[model samples]
Target: MEPTQWTLTETFQFPAEYGKAVSAQEVKVTAGYTEHQTEDAVRLSGIYHVAANVGFDGEGKEATLDSDAILIDDVDVQDQSGYFEYAVPLLVDLPTSADGQLTATVIDASATATDDGSLAVMWTVEAKLANVEAVAQNVEGELTKTALATDETAKESKQEVAQVTEETTTAAVTPDLESSQVETVTGYVDDNEMLAFINDLEDDVTVTSFRLNDVFVE
Candidate 1:
């Protein structure tokens, strides 16, 4: 038989709205997973993935700024204060039995100016998540059944003979487990700080929406 593969993805938003602004200079992301054992010798595992769209606001001395790698201003040199979008991928592993959990952490964040000093960027990270590569196996085995019968017969002149009969059968079995679950999570640098910064920016920086992808092959 051929082995098949599948993937599940989910998206999340932080600071849900722009009006509730905060101030920050940098953003960081972290990933984690879980594991377990099945009735069979085979091990069960869960894989996790994380990503984010960072929002930034820049100002002061007309400088350049980079938000999670997105370039805010380069050609136009001036006191820059605006938001930019940036994203990155994170991964981890764990042993999962019937079902496993997946989550995301903001870790940390901040804002700053780029080379040539073109902007006072306001930065924030909105985390994205996905649970991937979860696996399960059939371990316990199959069940068998058997039956026996006995009979007596008389032959020629009161002679008796004994006879026996037997029957056997087997059936496959299914694993004792429930369906796996997929979820979405968010991590923020500092809501108060981000709000404080956004309140001051000339314009609010927008973060791209999160997305989820699920793939399966049989």
Candidate 2:
């Protein structure tokens, strides 16, 4: 009687492995609106990509998984469809694999001199990733500025008005809160003058920059 034969194989990709694990079983992209139009509209051509930035983590860490994967950029996409309904995986050749950040930058590949042709896309960038999921480290976060230093006098005036109203109203009787986790946000109130500053502060906020950048995914 003859013996049997067996073989074991595994495919290790650059910087990482593409397994049945949490990898992109399939990516489904939805088309969103454009941002701005270029003068030629040729520059108006919309394009985007998904990329990963691999770097070595501090010692004690095995390696960085950033470059092992790359972003799916417009240039790499197949022109199989007329519209932008494409997605590519971040496959990079990483030397290590412990920590890294992957960014899916929707590029505006316009040959314009100025940043005049920025597109305001109403696009929804989603992914069908495996256990190897991706998350952005940097988002255009918003800034909340409720009171303007220049409005110091104005706020004082308004707070005075609010205090008067509050004092006159019997409805000012707030329920007595009694809890172990009572968090009374005490602030320096110069004779109760800051109350009027609470106007439409929602509309007074703005996002000036990307607060956090070092995002990682596996």
TM-scores of the models, in the given order? 0.21, 0.17
Q: Estimate, for each residue in 29-81, the C-alpha lDDT of model 1 and write its tens digit.
A: 33333433445422323333232223324322232222333332212212321
lDDT of 2 by residue, 1-218 (tens): 11112221111112112111112112222222233323432111233332222111112222233333222222221121111223333222212222232222322221111121111122233222212332231221211133354477788999999998988684557655653224343433532454445443466564344445654545
| Model 1 lDDT at residue 210 | 44
Candidate 2 matches the true fold with a TM-score of 0.17
Measured by lDDT, the strongest candidate is: 1
Give the poorly placed runs of model 1, Cα more than 4 Å off. 1-79, 94-99, 114-218
lDDT of 2: 0.28
Model 1 earns a TM-score of 0.21
